[model samples]
Target: MPDSLPPPTPGEELIKRIAVRVREARKSRGLPRRVLSELSGVSPRYLAQLEAGEGNISVILLQRVAGALDLKIDALLAENMPLDRDAERMAQVFSKASPDIQQQVRALLFAHSQTELRAGRICLIGLRGAGKSTLGKLAGEVLGLPFIELNKEIEAALDMPIAEVLALYGQEGYRELEAEALERVSATHDRMILAAAGGIVAEKTTYVRLLQRFHTIWLHTSPAEYMQRVRAQGDERPMEGNPAAMTQLKTLLDTRTPLYERADSQVNTSNRPVKASLKDLLRIIEKRRFLDVLDG
Candidate 1:
């Protein structure tokens, strides 16, 4: 009998998987090997050998190739959770979709998924002084649901005030904490009223998760009213040592308007009493059935 070939080692199997994923991802995007090499800053010859499953590429080089192919390194390395052909094709299609179409697709998928992901969770989003805290508290009380301010959750988790957290961790660190805090909240609470920081929408991944997991309401007011309410809360920093504070505030409002508009609903609180705004907020919740979740 002819000599049988030896079985491939575990390392060899992993290299083969990586090779296939890289080649398939690159080809699906219509990227030539030379183009990929240029994008990844790895030699074309190395890429060629890697794709042929002969090269024992290092993790760093493989990471570069994965980046060039617009894939996570974990995607290439995962053994049990292999990407089926249909899913790979769908991922490519989704990557090229417009933002609006992508959002619609996400909403549709979330709606059809087995789990009630949103699960009666409601989030209020907008600039500070938009009555998120006030209305969230009031609505939670009336509806007999828990009310959570996401920043406060972060503060409690870190055992520090928000100002101290910001001072200690800087903005990037704070944002990381914010995202973690959001995840914690989502995992812990199936039904609650959440008031998120205004800037949460600036983080795309975190914001998308929030939208998918909660019925978000944009609590908005005129810039003037926003400033007035902030001052009324005994926060004088907005006007302290900033001659162009109002202008800066208006510019920020303009920049973030589109992001805030992505919320599932909006309540205008400009020139309105808290009680009246709370009524409108409650009406929106009832009219939109934000808290209703269909059983699987």
Candidate 2:
């Protein structure tokens, strides 16, 4: 008879849990190993070892894998609990803190989880064709705050077209540039209106940071209205004669709705004039004192 395999050490058991979580998440999403490897910049062999619970990974590597998996590390390490949005965000913040700080934060969150975090900076978040740029500019003018488009900032910082950034650096590279641009702009301007790239919510770390550092507003619009606006602007790149374009757009909106919903407030532009929408957004800012208020 073959000898029984020795029990896994405690640390090995933890590693096994993580590996199982990673493999299950990838498989559940029907993502092939090569796809995950490509998305994560991790080798297929390394991912294989990870799935088999035979390889030790560094924190940075684990973070890369988790981000590519569209999961928080805490979820990967969760103790048999199904992950939810609140759990994911909590884990994102908790995992980034020191042990002592984590304890303090736990108590604080328990005591006042409902407390709002409103920063002085105004950040607009939404999908494309939702009037983030147009509304953001108008709001900035009205509020006397400088207007910044994060995409333009990323382009200037990289000194190239965004298409080139995607070609050269990939999605991860673009996210790095996006975060850096946000920091540079936030550092330079004490109070400004920032129109973030539509997909910024997909970057967990950056999105969480934005939540902590800005008064975010989701610019909501109907899928039909969104398509109409996109066409009105002469940008049909998304459709390009695809009959299922609206379906695709709705899918994206549905997937990202939860993330966008995390904003401090929402201003719907559907069935409303741009001026009216801007006025509604301005009132939100006034209520929060987001504009013209410097951080202490």
Candidate 3:
């Protein structure tokens, strides 16, 4: 036998380092799993696995998680070495960037992400009360595909109610579980309709994955309608006595609108009956498939 064993692969080393750094940052920041999950759109279970050095995370996902923790991607990926002056400067630049500038920078990393889609999966993306849950299920039934709510998947993964998970592990933990749940569903099922969380667009990396792997549709409605719908559905959180709640929500919508608009298809379901909106969405899907066949 040789005097020394073979060295670890580059990929293996990277995974180990990422596992350590991600866990360290989470603990240092005093962020629980749910909080990180909400911010990064990565699942707590997956983050747990990553911290355990068992996660096979992609660079894109890692970058997203790192950005959420306010770290530079390069710094996060760096091996167990002290940060050089240049690296520190780069991190500072990234940390201080305007939101628009940061988005533009991140966009460069996904240049080749959307060349083709998995064809068998479809995702609904939009803000809360956009009717993703309702419209997504109808679309699934019409198309004979299984309808999956991503939040429900997160709960199942954690074996607890979402609120409990959030309360126990924090938002970071919840998002980590959520992202892993989405990944599991994507890997396990070939044909399904996913009703993603309204804030899915906030995490560009996860949203990019959704866009690349699934045909995405934006279920859109007006701000007033969105609030009314959520209230009507008995989700009292939106109506909590914050007098400026509507203003805050509208501001959030404004910021996310551009991201939502990037979907492959869009249905503005405002002021329309459910049947009418569903019919319009079905037509969109059918027409797209017909065109896809023509291309093929």
The TM-score values for the models, in the order shown, are: 0.62, 0.59, 0.59
Instruction: Compose the digit string of candidate 3's lDDT tens values, residues 137-166.
Output: 998888888999998988777788878988
Against the true structure, what is every candidate's RMSD?
14.5, 20.4, 18.5
Across 263-292, the per-residue lDDT of candidate 1 in tens digits comes to 888999988888999999999988987778
lDDT of 2 at 208: 83
**Candidate 2 residue 101 C-alpha distance from true site, Å:** 19
Off by over 4 Å in 2: 1-118, 292-296
Stretches of candidate 3 exceeding 4 Å from the true structure: 1-116, 290-296
Compared with the true structure, model 2 gives a TM-score of 0.59
**Candidate 1 worst ten-residue window by lDDT:** 80-89
Model 3: how far residue 278 lies from native, Å: 0.3
The residue-level lDDT of candidate 2 at 280 comes to 93
The worst-scoring run of ten residues by lDDT in candidate 3 lies at: 287-296
Ranking by TM-score: 1, 3, 2
Q: Over the stretch 34-58, how does candidate 2's per-residue lDDT look in tens digits?
A: 9999999989999999999996988
